[model samples]
Target: MTDIHPTAIVETGAAIGENVRVGPYSTVGPNVRLADNVVLESHVVVAGHTEVGAGTHIFPFASIGHKPQDLKYAGEETRLLIGKNNQIREHVTMNPGTSGGGGLTRVGDNGLFMMGSHVGHDCKVGNFAILANNATLAGHVELADHVILGGLSAVRQWTRIGTGAIVGGMTGVEFDVIPFGSVIGDRARLAGLNLIGLKRKEFPREQIHALRAAYRDLFDTEDGTLRARAEAVAETAADQPLVKMVTDFILEKDDRRFCTPRSGE
Candidate 1:
């Protein structure tokens, strides 16, 4: 029971699942697969080796599953995998991965990608993430579940944003962000804990209090290096999963530095 507009063009090899809808002027490439309950609004172009999971809705002019933007890309058969229940708004662009980046760009379920937002090639976005209008991720970035990027924000390539972190508007994030952390600035200085997000998630008040304490210990104290402090916090707060999440993120091996509080603030 699929509905395809007369003006739509679905290539012969494209797989359109049951109950899907294709709007006018949209194009589905031969290698594209639209799962059950998918909806493609007018003027959409889903190309390359892309798979749209069930219950996903794509708005007009979304150039999804396009070839990687990298200069090194040479017509390789890379893939873009979009998970279920995503709302991809107008003018959003998502590219497939290049051979150099494992040949895959994957997005998890329930993401809200606002207008003009871009998910660059080779990026991995987790579930429940929200990319506000014009937010962008460079290639090779990793965004964990429940992360929020404010309008006009951008994440640098190779950086990782841990779960529940929030980046404020117009920020340019060049380093890893710890779990539940809040960062704001033109250059992304760590602001504080994501207290609003934590509370919205309904985390226990005691756990939230412990996490705040650990945050102060990890950043406010000047007694040791950040790694040393994170290690100490991890040991003492072993019973706090949220605290451990941040400490583990800090301890993980990565080439980039992390966002830190600015001087005198």
Candidate 2:
């Protein structure tokens, strides 16, 4: 029940599901698995222990599930897991995890990875994330759902971007970004809330209003500590899921510094 081109090479032990379409000159390695309705355009290379979930479409020349590009990597078996309904565009490169940083690079559902984007080793990309053209995430970065990385943006290793945050084009993120935060500039700094994104997602007006108020109290006001402010806001906005997400992100224990607003803002 699959449509595979004669030029395509489906290696032995590869598991391809019903309604899958393999195009010209593509290669599916022995350890690869493609679920139902998956489409691999011409010249795609899916190697290693990679699994393409159902309803995903991969464009031409993507090299996925390849060996990690770490000098310390020593042939340890690792895996790349892509979720359903993802649109992986041309020339994107996603590497598996390295032994030093766990053994799996996982991407969640409904992601849009544009041309030339790269997900480095051991990254965990959440659902509904968007990586614009040439966006790059260094090893061990974590992107929460609804996060958007603008074209040419690069995130440093060990950084985490919380849900609904957006990093502007050409920015370099060296620290963790808060939920719903919008940032721009070469060395990215917090730039208020992602108002447009919140609106587009149709978040309830009351929730949005509460989030805005919380943002001000957490960042604008001189608080005892970020965690303390987050907890206070969480207590007040107990019914708001978005508020909890923001507080939870703030409370996450990580070595990386938190991204803050520029001076004189």
Candidate number achieving the greatest TM-score relative to the actual structure: 1
Clashes of each: 0, 0
The local lDDT score (0 to 100) that residue 93 gets in candidate 1 is 98
- The local distance difference test score of each candidate is 0.96, 0.93
- Indicate the residue-level lDDT of 163 in model 2: 88
lDDT per residue for candidate 1 within 85-140, as digits (tens), equals 99999999999998999999999999999999999999999999999999999998
Q: List runs of model 2 lying over 4 Å from the truth.
A: 254-256
What is the clash count of model 2?
Answer: 0
TM-score of each: 0.99, 0.95
Per-candidate RMSD, Å: 0.8, 1.4
Off by over 4 Å in 1: none
Candidate 2 lDDT tens digits, 193-253: 9999999999999889988888888889765977788788888888888888888888777
Using lDDT, give the best candidate's number.
1
